[model samples]
Target: MSDEDEGPLVKKSRIFYGSLEEKERERLSRETAGTGKLKDGVKAGIAAGNINISSGESMDLEERVSERQSEVLAEFERRRRARQITVSTDDAEVKACLRALGEPIIIFGEGPAERRERLRNILSVVGPDALKKSKKDDDKSKRSQEERQETWYHEGPNTLKEARLWLAKYSLPRAMKRLEAARAHKEIPESTRTVKQQELHKNLRNLNNFCSQIGDDRPISFCQFSPNSKMLVTASWSGLCKLWSIPDCTLVRTLRGHSTNVGAISFHPQATLSLEDSDVNMVSCAVDGSVKLWSMDSDEPVADIEGHSARVARVTWHPSGRFLGTTCYDDSWRLWDLEAQEEILHQEGHSKGVHDLHFHPDGSLAGTGGLDSFGRIWDLRTGRCVMFLEGHLKEIYSINFSPNGFNVATGSGDNTVKVWDLRRRRCIYTIPAHQNLVSSVCFQPTDGHFLVSGAYDNTAKVWTHPGWSPLKTLAGHEGKVMGVDMSPDGQLIATCSYDRTFKLWMSE
Candidate 1:
């Protein structure tokens, strides 16, 4: 082919590497060219100007077509970007914007979509700066809307005010004492702390699943160790919660109360140690929307706390043992006054069902995780959300505050565990800790020296502090591990599984 017929060098270069389809079709055509009759037809067609095969003139025509296609694509891309310029889609909003720009709000018979598009084009031509005034107005309206939704005042009984006052008074000293203890903990030499951590790590590495007991006929939904660590309670989908003596795994008592799947159970902070046996020693909530408080001496509930409109996923006792926090599937969490046997605070913040919550050792704050993939920390005294725990890519299933009072660990359906530093107000570490959705997380009740996570992977993992290193993986469950808890002394770990059994792990 002649250089003049080859078109401009730039256009020729664009087609030098022919399209993949053209190359494949050419290869196919060459492979089928064995018959002379086919070649004769092709020759005749080419002479009649019906077919042209890679000739210089055809190349020029192809370049021109390609240039036209390039222009069209560039124009389309420019319009797409312009269309993406921010403009409210509401018809009234579009008309208002047009009015603000001194343009006609309507055209002959233009519908909503067309009117919106016309406004978008105008805004694109004038640029985003033109919307500054309307944007400010919109921002003001949005802020008002958010404020209304962020804080809702629910009038409780007249006792609620007194309860708040009591709580404010009750939490201060505990917070002070906790801060003092944290300071003393920090005063310990790093060398000593390191040695202690190493010992803990060694013990965790030595952990072995020693006993597995079928605690229920159905899947166990939750489990917790009593404050004294001598007893463990497992709640099951069979609607019963069973109390067992730890180490021996012997059934102590079966609390028959919930009429449906028992979703959560909690032992009072002072249960079996200082709290009276005849008082409220344990609290359990079920999918029947009932919360029951039981005494250690009775096989029946001592008090039936009601008010939840949906399933309660988790219940936790305040360190003071005066208040109870329950998370529900209704996207709300409530604080119950045990003395009054009434809900004192009905707080709504989560956009999805609240899955789990834990109280800080000081009892001044509560951290809750939800199916919305977010966790929020509420200041108990002021009833305000002070910190937002974000970063998980899927629903957060469990959350627990560290003994240090400033660190929080959350396990999520994203198959990861995140540690948030409240002092820094951000997520500090993300541990890809499981092969399946994480169902529960717990910190060592004494010093937060280690963390435990249970997951649908049929395994429970032990992680040591300082570096968040994996120390051991307890892998004996035949089904998904639904819950995990560490003994108060950190000497033992208990896990409940969907296999209808609960297992005990201890240093061997």
Candidate 2:
């Protein structure tokens, strides 16, 4: 099959050289020299002897030795003067002087004399004014770092203002309702909670493989369930979004608009529930740097949103369905208003490309995890970062806000899942989940009691949240698992994999 480098069907002999090659000879010689420490032309010796002198010679030698000693003492004194540090100020004044010189005012295990010496050494540099200018600049930078950012407002039309206000109105009630649920949740008797958890465990323990079906011609990159939990949408590398019947695993629809590999697919929150069949009910982002809104009956996209500079990796809608958020390879995330059809915020904070993001259950906050191995929680209303989730050591591939509303879960290429608490602003637990990259994590929406994680290790793991004990690891896929989701009723778990298939797990 060779052409340019060789004639067709010609076999070439492997090249192996003997010692005649200059480089080979030089390499051997260098190795020998390094290990043997061989040297050339070395044969010299000095005889050991002592002087026997006459009286006159001894007297001359004494005078010469005395002069040499005096010269040595003078040289020593000169070096000592160069290194010596002297200050006439008191101890406190000495510290103040050191502070002014931008030197340490106090050092551990150092006495007052040592402190004065440090001050003098600093004065040697700073009094010369070379360090003073640099130190002043450093101090100014420190002051600047200390000053927090004030509020920033984006001037928009009255619709934007109304949107923000409406979000506040909508989210506050949801948040309060969640809080009420939380309070009632805590009020449950410990014995009853234990029994209920046991029952939940009984259900979770039966999450064995039920079915596996070829989902696409190419690898499925993501899997999402409709709001009604009646259908499964699998976005594939073949640039197709496939819809399949739940449990029965039958093909229902194939939406085709993307020209390149589809990277992300998500169903609208109101899809198949309250939304019309003619409206935009599905959203997909692809490697061609576009986000397309799709409908159920049509094979084509209803609306095309453009302006992404690079491949869009993830797209999620605001819970209210008014805005859509996306992460792109351009090292930024963007918020687009669905009603206004304009970009509201183009947020850039990740050092590398952003990968995955999830909105809080109440819709006021969004958590974005990136290839930089860091995650950020942003306040959508205020356009300010509220917290930094920075512990993952590899690219964060997935982020999920817990149903509890205050805790967040993130999966990473580091083969771990970390649960973070918004109230405490710290990681509460780390689950050493997989032998390979953890591709996705989804909290079971039933009672915030369990989480399901899928990994490149070709398995999906179910975990109990409070103790984070592994409930079970379901292994059936032949390739890396790319995405996972649980049903709204918590009875089914679907995982899509690089093997061009999706699997469902059913409890006994």
Candidate 3:
């Protein structure tokens, strides 16, 4: 073409090197000895688009090309939505979905094929339930196999039925009262709530080292604040269970029950407050494979409930104050009838040692966590498995139920605190809580506003929930913090540390 027709700025293209027999441009353009020739249409398209083509070819070029073609087809199929999934052509579900998508359900002179294709495209954008149904249908066989393998079959003693009914009867009234109290609490004036919350925050921030006493010769493993928050009960590796007056550090009583290290200790919900001192006011479990009941006035155990063949790791009181749930290294947790003084249920489900357990605030459900890196929630009334908490990557060490009735908190050796929602049936929040394993966790008693977690990192931390934000860190321990508890009165924080002492906290 003439320069005048080509554009005023046109210039001659440059060559790669001095012109020779085998020029770079010539070698690139001409076919070499043996190579896969491009298809005529591909060559035409490449020339039309001014695409670059290299001279050499791979030895496995055909295999690679086939693989690439298959991948392209698979991706196309994955993205395609030409056919709709509908159980019935005239079903109202499909019609409702179509209407919601603002699509025409029927077109003039359209057969079922066209209508279905239109619905498919529309549902791809709007998310029809039938799409889920179709995916589930494809997975139905795999799911059935899993269901068959996951069948949990266990039969307790014949008295299990009576125990379940009794639990139902005892827990129903408490559950009702708790719900009513929660409703009333929510209905309170915003001003009243603010004032109460401010008071609590002030008290919590004022929590400081009140007193530290050497109650045990060995490291303390567990510590609990009484229901009245007037005293503290601490168990140690020396096999001693000691009760000391709060703030004063005065030893009130020493109950020498276990011959080995005490692993768990808990007071009855009514202990030292309403129940008589002669009643079985406290329970403790030890590494000696025995659980013992104690009274306020006795230096010896009031009763011995012996059935475990391995170490008893944890003891938890039911909200009804009539049942006790204990975890053992025997790969099981058992429920004890405190009134009848007998073992009511011997439940075994964990693959490894059961380490910790807690009853739901309403007492109708119980949760257990263990060395298996998972936790299970059980229906107390029917003994059926309710939910599985499976996100912890290491052994679960502590569990606590929130007063709100739907949330559970678990501390694990993975150094994380996970909060689960029973209603959502999933882990709702995971707090990267400690540098080492988390050892214990507890939620505030009445309002369930805050959770306290202790860890082997030599720290105890408080976290506020719903958002799960760290509130404060209590870092005075000289060694690993083993146990933590929040008082029902919201006035005390107790922690047992491997430093061989239990510290008390109060505002200023």
Which one wins on TM-score? 2
lDDT rank order: 1, 2, 3
In model 2, which regions exceed 4 Å deviation? Answer: 1-81, 85-159
Instruction: Give lDDT: candidate 2, residue 373.
Output: 96
> TM-scores of the models, in the given order?
0.73, 0.74, 0.70
Q: Top model by lDDT, which number?
A: 1
Candidate 3 residues 66-175, lDDT tens each? Answer: 67557655544433433334435664665555555556666799776666666766565455675566656657978887776462757777677888998888789988
lDDT of 2 by residue, 164-232 (tens): 677788889999999999999999999999999999988888778898999888999999888888899
Ten-residue stretch with the least lDDT total in model 3: 12-21
Local distance difference test, candidate 2? 0.84
Indicate whether candidate 1 or candidate 3 has the larger lDDT.
1
Ranked candidates (TM-score, high to low): 2, 1, 3
lDDT of 1 by residue, 1-508 (tens): 6656776874565465346436654654564454345667766898998886755563344455457557655655556566468777788988988887888998999999988888888776677687787678778999999887574655667767787788778878977988888789889999998888778788788899888999999999899989888999999999999999988999999999888999999999899999899988999999978999999999999888878889899998988898999999999998988788777888899989999988888777899999999999998767789998889999999999998888999999999999999999999999999999999999888888889999999999988775888999999999999999988977789999999999999997
Q: Which stretches of candidate 3 lie over 4 Å from their true place?
A: 1-151, 189-199
Candidate 3 displacement at residue 265 in angstroms: 1.1
> What is the lDDT of every predicted structure here?
0.87, 0.84, 0.83
State in Å the error of residue 382, model 3.
0.4
Error of 1 at 292 (Å): 1.3
